[model samples]
Target: MSLVSPEYIRYFYYGAIVIMIPFIISDLLKKKKEDKIDGTKHFKISVYNILIAIAMMVVLFFLINSNYPS
Candidate 1:
């Protein structure tokens, strides 16, 4: 049995999103409570997190789509 099967990779992809949800939510909540002066900092962090998540998804898609011998 291969460790890098599609099923396992799919699970990992889902898990990564699930893990990222809390960080996103917290960043939003924090941004809402902060003053305008600090808004840009929080916004930058939120955007960075979102970009990283997107990059991860793209990488995972390629990993899942690639054909490998079992």
Candidate 2:
């Protein structure tokens, strides 16, 4: 048996990706209001999170479809 269920992993990844939407929106708004403030850091972090979410989606797909031990 797997230590963690694939369903739970799937939900977690989906939740993580969804939860970042508001933060991204907030960052954009903050950047617009404060022109001098640097937003590249927030953008970079969002990109990193997106990449990780994508990777986790692939992993979750594999885990759900394959018989490999988790």
Candidate 3:
């Protein structure tokens, strides 16, 4: 009954992750010239974001698989 298929949604989710990773890396690696700070803060935030994204993606994969006809 849904307008969009789960396969497309899954692909979109993956595409989003692909697009997001580069920006996350950029944030992690970019110099903080204004505050003269190092990258520890960015590293922690980037790691947290990556972990959360992986967990969510795993959950999404299971949810999508469960909805498919078996």
Candidate 4:
């Protein structure tokens, strides 16, 4: 058996998105109450988290698409 199979890649891709949902939701909820808060730290954190998730997705895509011996 070989590692990094296509099916595993798909699962990793979807898993990353699923894991990010809660963070996204929290970010949205925070935005709704932005008026009450004073700092931009949470916003920055959320953006960073989103960017990291995207990076992971991209990496997974490339890994999955790369040519490898079956």
Q: Pick the candidate with the highest lDDT.
A: 1
* Candidate scoring better on lDDT of 1 and 2: 1
lDDT, candidate 2, equals 0.74
TM-score for candidate 2: 0.43
**What is candidate 3's lDDT per residue for 1-70, written digit by digit as tens?**
1256864887787888899979866765663332246424655665687799899999989988896776
> Candidate 4: lDDT of 36?
49
What's the number of clashes in each of the models? 0, 0, 0, 0
Residue pairs with backbone overlap in model 1: none
Report every candidate's CA lDDT.
0.78, 0.74, 0.70, 0.76
lDDT of 1 by residue, 1-70 (tens): 1375865887788888899989878878778577375645776677788799899999999999889865
The sequence of per-residue lDDT tens digits that candidate 2 reaches over residues 1-70 is 1356865887787888799989878986675555547534665555577689999999989889998676
TM-score for each of the candidates: 0.46, 0.43, 0.47, 0.49
> Candidate 2 has which clashing residue pairs, if any?
none
Error of 2 at 64 (Å): 0.5
TM-score between candidate 4 and the true structure:
0.49
RMSD of 4: 6.5
Span of ten consecutive residues with least summed lDDT in model 1: 35-44
Off by over 4 Å in 1: 1-35
Structure candidate 4, residue pairs in collision: none
